[model samples]
Target: MRRVLAALAAGAFLVTASACGSSGDSTGSDKASSSGGTTKVKVGVIPIVDVAPLYLGQEKGFFKKQGLELEVSLAQGGAAIVPAVASGQYQFGFSNSTSLMIAQSNNVPVKVVSNGIASTGVQGKDFGALTVKGDSSIKSADQVEGKKVAINTLKNINETAVRESVRKAGGDPDKVKFVELAFDQMPAALDSGQIDAAMVVEPALATVKSQGAREIASPLVDVAPDLTVAMYFTSTSYEQRNAAVVKRFQAAVAESLAYADAHPDEARQIVTTYTKIPAAVLAKVTLPAWPAEPDRASLDALQKLGQDDGLFKTAPDLDKLLP
Candidate 1:
């Protein structure tokens, strides 16, 4: 979540805002040809709870309903996706607003067409957490001051949310030293006393605790109420050129999202088919509520946070970014 462009999917799952030097325009074009009216699209994804709705969409044949023959691929990170989507290597990408805002500053022709998940009270409890070794002296956010903190990625969702959480708990986030590490390495790092706290997500949150890490606090839904934690984004050009196709996909996705929200266990089962995480770990993992539509205010706040964090130089034009 290590601030690197490339990473393992379910293990360390990093998503940074860094750029990838790939030749291409912001206009998206499908690399693979589709027979007749079928439009084949390459979609970049990451195996995480945020992407559950996409699994639901594919399982329910939402893409097929839209005449989109989608080939989903795991992205190295959120940064690699801009070029992948822009070069037509991928028609769309699954990313959080943290990377989206950063890409917008670079004039990336991408727009979040739909919402994936929003932090709704306890519903998104397992979305993210800050942890310390169970035997460590640190028991609260205040103990993290002047301490070493690890995050999967810097200046992205994990760190930003952790920073806000620390501030909310009357701690100076600036006083802590930040380091980038994989999600899986957190438990070992904490046990080795290499880091005082680590911001992690999913099975790793549960895994870290099982390794004797205690949760000091979690920012999943507590830091920002109903925040748009995940979304499906496509290049603006793709949306413009394939208006009817996009609408069809959106409609079908809306249906699948509602279905997944109603039948979470079924949704989780479908996700396990593609992800490397075990079913037992997945069973206890906190899944998010699949929202049917993107929240305008939550998205705006995310973009604002990017600007505030200096991840973006200018405010992104939401009209061009959102559906």
Candidate 2:
């Protein structure tokens, strides 16, 4: 995971270094190719339950109705997608709010175009949680102190939320050893005792539970009620030059989110198209709130917690970043 971070950090540095050399042309006319009045655009996304709405949207003709055809490209995580979008490798991308904030703080020139996913705000029932082996002695977040707890990314949203959970549980978050492990690998790692605990979301969380893993804390919910965990974003360059396209995309995604939130069974069905999550496990997986719009108050709460955890070098400009 350290190697992945290092590679992504290098990619980000290259993106920052090349910002000044960009052509700054209108992407609507130059980048996005129109075929029979349909603008085809590529979107980088992580294949997770959080992104089910996008597939559902595509299937429901939400993007087609807007005259935009989406080409979904799967990536490992948001850390990789941010730079890819900033460099115009993709017209847009899905990412955790913290990662986008970090990129914006580092002058990566990204803009949030639409909300992605949010917590359910119910402890033990949210889409994401911090968990331990069912028979493990650790019963709460505080018990993770001096113990190895795995998070998908270091110094990102999950880490910040987990830290807050530990703090709220009356433990010193600094004392907990945080290891970087991908979400899919977490269940096996925890079962093998390779890690003391893991912070997981969606299908992975369901797999962990099937293994008799117990939820110790709902970290995302601990951050804030209905916390805006992730969002869809584009390069500021793309947004500025392709205003019409961006507007169309925003409307399409908003409809998609609303549709997914209302038709959860369809949302679950859509997950099979993009991810390998088992049918039984997928059925048990908790679906996150696909709010059509981001909750600003929730974002503010996340920003404060991120700042407290030193996740940002400079405070992200929410006014400029948000659509």
Candidate 3:
């Protein structure tokens, strides 16, 4: 995953190069092809609980109502999706706020269009958590000092959240050894004592809980109340050339988010269509908040954390990045 993120950071240059070419018109046409009054667009997404609203929205005919047809492409993570969207392979992509900030700071041509997911702002009940084994000596984030901790990606949102957790618990985050492990693989790794703790989100969080993992902290909530964890975004070039389509998409997604947030059962059911999570585990999954509008204050708090952590090349210009 580290190698993948490194590749993604390096691929930012490819996006910059592509943005400089005369392919904008052609790419825009390919991105939103209209036929019989319907615009077909490809979206790159991670097959996780956070993206359940998009599948639900499609099933609920929200996109269809906007005359938009979605071709959803599943990827490993935002690292892969960001570059694909910027290179014009996908019209839009879903990614965590930090990854998007990193891209924008590096001058990658991307613009956030709509909110994706947010922390529920309730400790021990949030969708994501910092967990240790059932019988581990570590009972709080402060105890994680000098221990091996796992995050999905190094120097990304999860890492930032975990560090904040440690700091809030009065521990020096720098003293904690961080490791990169995918969400799916974390359950077994934690069970087998491969790592002392893991920062995980649903349905993996549910799986970890099923294995008797003890939740020590809700790291995302610790970062800020209702932290805007992720958002749906498009390349700047695509947004520039396809304003009408982007507007339609933003509206459709906002409607989708409201519908899913209002109907949690439907959201959980939709996760089955894209992911292989079990029925029992799916029931145990905690759904994230899906507000129609991004929380600017929460984003500001997150940006400050990222800046202090040196996660960006230059501070992201939220005025230009936000819709």
- Index of the highest-TM-score prediction: 2
Candidate 1 wrongly placed segments (more than 4 Å): 1-32, 184-188, 191-194
Per-residue lDDT tens digits for candidate 3, residues 86-151, read: 767789989999988888887788899999999999999999999999999999999999999998
The residue ranges of model 3 lying beyond 4 angstroms of the native Cα positions read: 1-30
lDDT of 2 by residue, 150-230 (tens): 987778899999999999999999999999777888999999999999999988999999999999999999999999999
Q: Which lDDT value does model 2 have at 144?
A: 99
- Residue 99 miss distance in model 1 (angstroms): 1.2
| Cα lDDT listed for each candidate | 0.69, 0.87, 0.86
Question: 212-263, model 1: which lDDT tens digit per residue?
Answer: 7788877655446678777778777778887776676677667778888998
Indicate whether candidate 1 or candidate 3 has the larger lDDT. Answer: 3
lDDT of 2: 0.87
> Ten residues in a row with the worst lDDT in model 1?
1-10
RMSD value for candidate 3? 5.0
* Candidate 2 lDDT score at position 170: 99
After TM-score superposition, the amount by which residue 183's alpha carbon in candidate 3 deviates from its true location, in angstroms, is 1.3
Residue 162's lDDT in candidate 3: 93
Query: Candidate 2: where are CA atoms >4 Å away?
Result: 1-8, 11-30
